[model samples]
Target: MTFRTLLMASTAAALLAPAAQADVNIYSYRQPELIQPMLDAFTQETGIRTNIAFLNKGLVERLQAEGDRSPADIILTTDISRLSAAVAAGVTQPVDSAVLEENIPAAFRDPGDQWFGLTTRARIVYASKDRVDPAEVTTYEDLTDPKWQGRICTRSGTHPYNLALVAAVIHHHGEEAAKTWLEGVKANLARKPQGNDRAQVKAIWAGECDISLGNTYYMGKMLEDEEQQDWANAVNVLFPEFQNGGTHVNVSGIAMTRAAPNRDDALQLMEFLASPRAQALYAEVNHEYPVSPTTEASDLVQSWGTFTPDDVNLMDLAALRGTALRLVEEVDFDG
Candidate 1:
């Protein structure tokens, strides 16, 4: 064969040689835009291409159905319940990573290493700066006081965020106290739990309510939107605590699927997410507190002021989620 033909043949063969297999497939419950930047950074740093399937619901069932044939290497999601469910469903395998251990706190990770939290967001109170005295709402327990009747607002009680908070209440004070607290909070709502966290702030601005329950990050989101900036401006972020513990908080976390096709590449991506660089990106994009002690929260989040997060194990919150939902129904929290 001619030299030119031989060289062309060799080049074509090299180009078609299965592409070196540098990709990690992810089954994610987190929204694409919120996680895309960090995934891009991971790819840029490590050259491991990311293939993600964003699912709003049914991730666990889907993973179970795929079984051993699943192409997913990682499961990315928010809320401890989903992470814990993945483990209970036997769809995740334990990871023993020194990098993960060093970066994530024990409370933020599964004891068996089945999952790891990347960031935390506090469930806090947003009180009207113009009409409400911050002193009137110093604790989650205080929101139930008759003095605040018809003065509070919130999203549905069934939202994963509120369910986690209710679960925390159960973990701290027992099921009975949690049920009572749920009913009390319900009795005080200005309107039947009607809108999202930001909408609750808008309600406060519109004089529809004086205080509302929300995640700290929503305040940052509201501030970034011109229409919602006024709503954000009308409220002061309040870090209400448990009567005996710190503020209730939730997380966005990661897990390795049981059928990981690229174990080494998946491990690299998991460790990268736990690193300071990825933690900082989480803080920047989602306005959440970094799970790593070495990473700092964004300045805007810091400006909202800081508070002590409750030391309750997130797994406990996940464990009690069923009871929390039942209590929400018992109280007719949305009705």
Candidate 2:
């Protein structure tokens, strides 16, 4: 069936489902399968049913269209950009919860408490084990060196993941320097920016590029896929740092919608997500680092080695997104 048909069906199902006495409705950008386990646990623990509609794009517009009558109590999404946009668009409301404040680092949540990051994934380099020396690529700036010309692979510059990384570069080094670095990396491309992070690893396996940029969690996902195991095995995950800071990171976060019909239940679910139990489930299912300092990464993710994450507040990254996108266009990085 077409994706549109499936999406409509899901939306219909969500709208038609009978509401429980205590329930929360979520409009999520996260895929259902990845989040269902946590939702189930929340329901079992709190007796609060959850109805979710997964949308790949246009979440804010949909919420805006529904206005105050929207059934959506929460918005669950990946990347700081989306969360920030939701707030900027006035589709989400500030949440005041001590549980969120205690479990999540201040850097991972908005100052106004509009959104809270549940899990984090670093934007790290994936180097071909046989072809690239790990010692040679220790930092993000190293990718721009002339020696690595025609050695890097990446997705489109406009992709939120890459933009967030570029934004961090801008955040640390200033706009002009970030632009130069972006152009240098673009010049070093093994091919025109294309495909998702995992595809870049497959490129390494095929000898298409010596290295590529990808999230830390993808390494775990690739290892679990039988057909992709060789691709995963072909590369060593490298946690590259900023020249003066730690590795760049991004998040999958949650926020309460402005028109939350079930405010009490929604707050309960939000607090539950920040709890140790949910954090552990996120690590296991999503291969992401939990936001809570007390929760450990899954063994598979832990085995990938560790590095200090750049302490740059994610809200700063969100702020520079426009400049980052403009720089990407200025350089025609994808071209």
Candidate 2 positional error at 219, Å: 0.8
Score each candidate by Cα lDDT: 0.89, 0.92
Q: Kindly list the per-residue Cα lDDT of model 2 for residues 229-333, writing each as its tens digit.
A: 999999999999998999999999999999998899999999999999999998899999999999999988989998999999898899999999999999999
Q: Least lDDT summed over 10 consecutive residues: which range in candidate 1? A: 10-19
Model 1, which residues run further than 4 Å from truth?
1-22
Candidate 1 overall lDDT versus native: 0.89
- Candidate 1 residue-wise lDDT, 17-93, digit = tens: 34254378787887667888999999999988876666778999988997897778899998898899999999999
Clashing pairs in 2: none
Best by lDDT: 2
Q: What TM-score would every model get versus the actual structure?
A: 0.92, 0.97
Best by TM-score: 2
